[model samples]
Target: MDEPKIKNMEEFAAVSGISRPTISKYFNDPDSVRKSTRRKIEAALDRFDYRPNMYAMNQNRRLTKNIGVVVPYLADPFFAEIARIIENHVLSAGYRPVLLGSHGDPDLEIDNLENLRLIKPAGVLLAPLGRVSDAERLAAFCADVPTVLFDANIEDLGAAFVGSDNDQSIGLIVEYLCRTGAPPAFFEIRNPVNPNANKRRAAYIKSIEALGHKPHLLQADGEGWEFEQIGFSEGTRIIQEHDLPTDTILCSNDRLAIGLLSAAYQAGLRVGLGDGCALRVAGHDDHPFSRYTCPTLTTVSQDYAAIAQKSAETLFALIDSSKHFDSREETLFNGRLVMRGSA
Candidate 1:
C-alpha cells in the first residue's frame, strides 16, 4: 500500500523527524536555517509534495517577522543613510523591514504608527519628530509595541533610545573652533523643530563658558526644514549689516552652514583658513554634502554606525525575549570632530 499523504506542516515535520520550530524557521527564510537542515527539509518537501501556506502561518504566529522603521523625514540624507544601515541589519536577522517617512509632520508621524500597528509588526524603530510629536499618542503606541527610538528622541517613549550624545559632540566642535581661532557664535533657527538643536544650543553655551568665552547666538527667523534657505537669507542679512558677533560661526547643522557659505560667497567674502579669508564656518552632523561644498565644511561627525547597530540590536533583543525592559534605556555615542578647510 502507498504511504499516506502529508496534509500539513505538522505531519511533514513528524515524517521529516525535524522539530516544528525548525521547520517553521526554514519556511520563513530558507537561508535562515543551516544548510544541513535546509537540505533535509527540501528532501522532505519533494517526497511529501506539501508546502506551508505562508499567509496562514504568519496569521497564526504570535508575532510577524516584520520590523517597522519610521523616520521623521526620509528625504534628509542623514535619515536615509541611517535607515539603510538599519535595513541591512534587519534583513540579516531574517526580518522584513517596513520603512516609512513622516516628512516632518506630527500628524503623519501618528498615522505611520497606526499603520504599523495594523501590520502587527514584531517590533519598531522610530525617529520621532520631536517637540511636535503627540506625546500621548506616542506613549500609548509604545505601551503596545516594542520600539527603539533613534536620532531624535522623546523622553520615556520607547523601549530604549540610541543616539549621539549632543553634549559631547557640541563640546568637541566648540573646543576645536575656539582653540583654532576666535570663539564662534552659534547660528540656528529661532524656533527649532528637532530636539537635538536645543541640546546642541545648551551644549554650545556650556562649552563656551567653560573655556571662558562669552556665548553668542544668531537666531534666524523661519520654520520647517528649509534650513539652507534660512541660513542663506539670514546669513546674508547678518553679513551685509555687520551683525555677526564673531568672525567664526558655528551652525547648528550642515544644511545651515551650506546656506551661510553661499551667502558669504555672494557677498564677496572669502571663507577658509588661508590668507585673505574673511570668515570661518563650521557645522554639526557632518552632513553627506558637507565635504563637497566649495570650501569643505568642518563639523562633528555623529557615530551613525553605532547608533544604527545599537538601535536595531535593542529592538531585536526586546522581540526575542518577548518582554519590555523594567525601565527605559538610553544609549548615547559621542561624536568625532572632522577638520577641513572651512574652519
Candidate 2:
C-alpha cells in the first residue's frame, strides 16, 4: 500500500479535474453540483483523506462551517439544555458550533457578537438579553451575519425567531389552575428580562378578565437570570406578610416557581390538589429541574426540541442560500400541558 498524495481541495481538484470553486461548492452542498460531478468527487474522497482546514477554508472563501450560538446565560439549565439540542443538530448538519454566553451582561453580549464576526461564521443563533441588548448593534450584526433568534427575540433584528407560544402556554396554565381551584395570581418579575414574560403577563390578564375573574398580578422584584432568588425572596415576603387574593399561583417560568415552592415550604404552606393543601402552584417552560422539586411542578412545557431544530435548520438554509430572502420568519411552538403534583 502507498500513502495517498492528495493534501487539500486544490490538490484533489487538480487530480480529479474539477475546479476548486466547484469542489468548495460541493463541500458546501453536495446537491448543488451535477450528479456526474458529485460522483467524481465521491470517488476522490474514497481514494484519499485530504480535507480542508476549517480555519483556512474560511480564510480562503467568504463562508465556512463555523456557526456562532450566543445566549444570554448558559448557566441556566433551560438555556443550557436548548443549546445542547441546537449544538447536536448543527454538528450533524456538518457545521461547527461555537457556544458563547452573554452572562446576562449587555456589554459582554455586544463583545461576543464582535468576536463572532471576526470568525466570519456562516450564521449565528442568538438568544439575546431582551430590552437590555443593544438593538442597534444587534441589527448591524445581523446585517453582516445571518442570525436566528431563539429564547428571547427582538422584532426585525434577526433573520428569524423560534420561541415558545407565550399566549398559549400561559393561558393554558392559568385556565387549568382556575378550573381546579380559585383563579390564580400571575407571579413574575416586575421588569422581565425576556420578551416572553411581557406576552405572558398580557395573556394572563386577558385570560383572567375573559373568564370573569380579576387577576391578582404579583410583581416579584428581581434582576438578571437569577429567577429563583427573586421568586424566593418575593414569594417569602408575599407569603408571610401579605394576604394572597387567590389560592393558586401561576409563575411565568418554572425557575421562579421553584423559588416560590421553597418560600411556601418555609411558610408552612401546603401546595397540591390534595386535602388540606392551601395553594395550587403552576409554572411555564417546564424547566429540566422542575421534576426534581420537592412536590414536583405542574407547568406548561415548551417544545424545546422543535424550537432548537427549526432554528438551526432555518439558519442553515440562510447560510446555504447565501442570500437574504424577504419576509421575516417567526415560529412560535405551542407548549404542552404537563400535569404534575404541584398544581
Candidate 3:
C-alpha cells in the first residue's frame, strides 16, 4: 500500500516518525540537529516531497524573524545600493528583509510601516523622508517596534541613527575646492526634500567663512526628488544669466551637479580644472553616475558599506535585546573627497 501524503509540517512529522519540535528545529537550522537526525529528515523530505511554509511557521512564533528596510526613495542608486547591502546582512543573520520604498510620499511611508507592523517584524531600518515625515506616527511605531534610522535623520527619534557626517564631508570638499581653485558657490534647491541638503548648506557656509571667503548661495526654485531636472533647468538659467559669483561651483549633491554639467555642455561652457576651462564643478555624494560624466565629477564619497553594516548590526542588537536603549544612539561616518577631472 502507498504511504499517506503529508499536507503540513505536523503531518510530515507524523509520517517521518519524528517529534514536531525536532522537525521544527531541523527546519530552522539543519546544522543544529545531529548528523543522523539531519540525514533522516532529508530522507523523509525526499520521500514525501514535503517542504515547510516558513512564513506560516513564523506566524505561530511570538516574534517573526523579519527585518523591515524602508527608504524614502529606492529609485535613487545610493539608497538602492545601501538597501541591497542591508538585505544581505539580514539574510546572513537568518532573518527575512522586507524592503519598501516611500517614493518621496509621506502617506506611502506610513502605509509601509503599517504593513510591516502587521507581519510583526523583529525590527526596522528606515531612511525616512526627513522634514516631511510624520514624526508622531514614527514615534508610535518606534515605541512598539525597534527601528534604526539611516541616511536622513529626524532629531530625537528611532533607537539609533547611522549615516554620513555632512559637516565633515562638506568641510572637506570646501577646503579642497578653495585650495585647488576659486571658492565654490553652493548650488542647491531652495526647498530641499532631504534634511541632509540643509546640513550640507550650513557646513559649506561655515567652511567658507572660516576660510575667509564670502559664501555665495545659489538657491534653485524647485521641489520633489527630480534633482536632475531641477539642476538642469536652474543651471541653464543661472548660466545664461551669468549669475555665478565664482568660477568654481560646488553642488549640494551629485544629481544637481549632473544637471549643471549637462547645462554647461549645452551652453558651450568648458568645465574642468584644465586651462581654458570656463568653470570648475564639484558635488557631494559620489553618485554612481558621477564618474561616468564627461569630465568625471569630483565629489565626496559616502561610506555606503560602513553605514549599511552599522545600521543592520544596530537593529539586530535592538531586536535581540527586545527593548529600546537607555538613550538613543547615532553613528555618523565621515566622507572622503574624490578628485577627478570635473573640479
Residues 1-343, candidate 1, lDDT per residue (tens digit)?
A: 6666887888988999999999998887798999999999999888877877654676777799889999988999989999999999999898889999999899999999998887788999999999888999999999999999999878889999999999999999999999999999999999999999999999999999999999999999988888899999999999999998889999999999999999999999999897999999999998999999989999999888999999999999999888999899999999999999999
* Candidate 1 residue runs with Cα over 4 Å from true position: 1-25, 29-57
- Model 1 has an lDDT value of 0.92
Q: Write one digit per residue (lDDT tens) for candidate 3, span 214-257.
A: 99999999988889999999999999999999999999999999
Ordered from best to worst TM-score, the candidate numbers read: 3, 1, 2
Task: Give Cα-based local distance difference scores for all models.
Answer: 0.92, 0.89, 0.93
Model 2 TM-score (2 dp)? 0.86
* Candidate 3 segments whose C-alpha is farther than 4 A from its true place: 1-7, 43-50
Lowest lDDT 10-mer window, candidate 3? Answer: 1-10
Off by over 4 Å in 2: 1-53
Positional deviation of residue 195's Cα in model 1 after best superposition, in angstroms: 0.3
Clashes of each: 0, 0, 0
> After TM-score superposition, what is the CA distance of residue 245 in candidate 3 from its true location, in Å?
0.7
| Model 2 lDDT per residue over 1-343, tens place | 9646786788888878889989989987888999999999898777776676666667766777899999889999999999999999999998899999999999999999999877789999999999888999999999999999998879998889999888888778778877888899899999998888999999999988888999888998878989999999999999987658888999988999999999999999999888989988899998999999989999999998999999999999988888875878999998999999998
